[model samples]
Target: MHGPEIVTTLLEMADDGQTRPTPSDAWHLFLSGLRQRFRLPSGRPLAVIAAVLIASIVGGFGAAAGSWAAERTFADLPSQARVEALTRQASPGDDYSYDRSTSAWGTDTTMGALTVSDWDPASARDRFAADGWQVTTVRDMSAGALAYTNDPATGSMTPLPVRGSQFDAVRDGVFLRVTGYVSPGHGTVSVMLWPDDTAAMLPLMLAGAVLGLVAGWMLAAAGAYRMRPLPAGRRRVATVLTGLAVTALALPAFAFYVNMTRVLGPSGSFVNTVHSALNASPYWSYSTPRMLLLLTVTGAVLAGAAWATMGRRGRSTPAADQIPTTG
Candidate 1:
């Protein structure tokens, strides 16, 4: 074909959208534009991009695992009747308090302790048995191990593998322990509970996995961009400051995302209730404030350092040595 005819055909194809770029093509074009705009080296940018992608994928799976565990833990909790029964079995003047701590994802433990006078271990065991509750006695009292199931029909007392200094008794959804001090003439009876059901977390896990992947990818990309090399001047200072700002903002963003992905309705309602209960506890209330304070201080320090470093660099570099803009 003649040159003019060939050109006219290409123009027609373009106008008709026959040659429009695919999503993949557009993504490549966008990356190219970014590389040119930031003067990023080809190899390093690719490596950084890959790292961000990997981080997002890993983060997504982590979120999924966490959500699943949380749901399962929430489902395994004992019935209110069982808790009430145990509490009522305590001595007449027993003082009760709740103690809880979360050590890992999907693992929440609450220990209810009752302090009683004239305590008797055998009496407590008998009390539980009288109430139709399964009672487990540890033969090696020194070792202090206990495991029992509350299932009325099939539950039985069993010996737990004795571990280190920690005194623990866990069975089904409740763990019980009675510790006495010879001098004080008083004993503390503690009931530890972990309620979990495997099926309860499916929907929330699915949603959190999806949303976490998207958010992780976005946050990763922003992080990589912030770390990109810049010509030493106001631009570098600005990038660093922006990064610090983004880092500071991430805490709230994470909290908001968690709230959005929370389980709802009858199916996973227990999980939501458990989360609410935990959040109201002192540990959560204090930890959140401390975390925010740490982030704020860290961000401010980093921003200040970036500003100082950039100002010093700017003063040392001659105007003539500054990078020239490309057309």
Candidate 2:
């Protein structure tokens, strides 16, 4: 119908008592308004968006995979049982107390102090050496300590002794160190045991990242293709939500990997020991479980939106058809 005739017909329908609007009418009108407002990108712009979305997915998955691999590498380290056993042993004439615990990030720490009468540094060194430990003095440990936590002036525990004499050794990939504070006739010795698997973990983490990148790329490509049929407005919203969810999912992985790197080596000018690194900042700032829950909720919402709008074919009306036409 022509414009005037169409308007008159609509006015006549509005005057009829039976022409009342239904709930469905309001809903369809709302959706129609949204479709007009949020135009979909076509051609090159759409392709570019798909590419960016795919990249985000791939990167997030890569980092997550690497972090998981790194954790496995740590857990696979030699003999936790043996390490725990050695960590609990104390020499005769020494009053010892120790505590052992594991962190959320999968680090095992054994720390304790020993009170001994007649503090003899040589005897202490020899005793550890006899246990097949290549013991070294605190001075040597300070010099050879990991650059990540070596601060001589601050007297931090990067394998350094606070007072008197300190000795440490590395065996079976475990760190064994003793810090002694001696007085007139006796002394208090602090002992710490830690596992060092950095040399084995980094390469595995890199490999995992590579694998995840490939997997994410494939998945993103398929997902983008599936979303092609959705309306521009819905597609864009879904894409943004998916991107953010992927980012949230991957955050802990990358953060963990970075923290591990810092713990193992120097992070710019900032230094960190494994204990201090895991227990401080970023890692301690938020809950991993909560971030994961967010990812799950976001995914569900995206899926529900898609199911509602994408139809049985999981496709929307063609982008070309949605474009306005004027004569």
Q: What range of 10 consecutive residues in model 1 has the weakest lDDT sum? A: 269-278
Per-residue CA lDDT of model 1 for 178-249, tens digit only, reads: 343211344445555555444545555556666656555554454344444446575556665646655663
lDDT of 1 at 250: 50
lDDT per residue, candidate 2, 1-327, as tens digits?
Answer: 033443344445564474654577658757864453333334547545644544544454454445444545442333445543443343334555667755544355677776765456677677778888877765322333222344689877454333366677766666677666644445566667766555544555455556655554554445555577777887777666665655554444455455556545643211122222233223555655355435545654654564344344333333443334569
Error of 2 at 168 (Å): 2.4
Total clashes, candidate 2? Answer: 1
Give the number of the best model, judged by TM-score.
Answer: 2
Best model number under lDDT? 2
TM-score on alpha carbons, each prediction = 0.40, 0.54
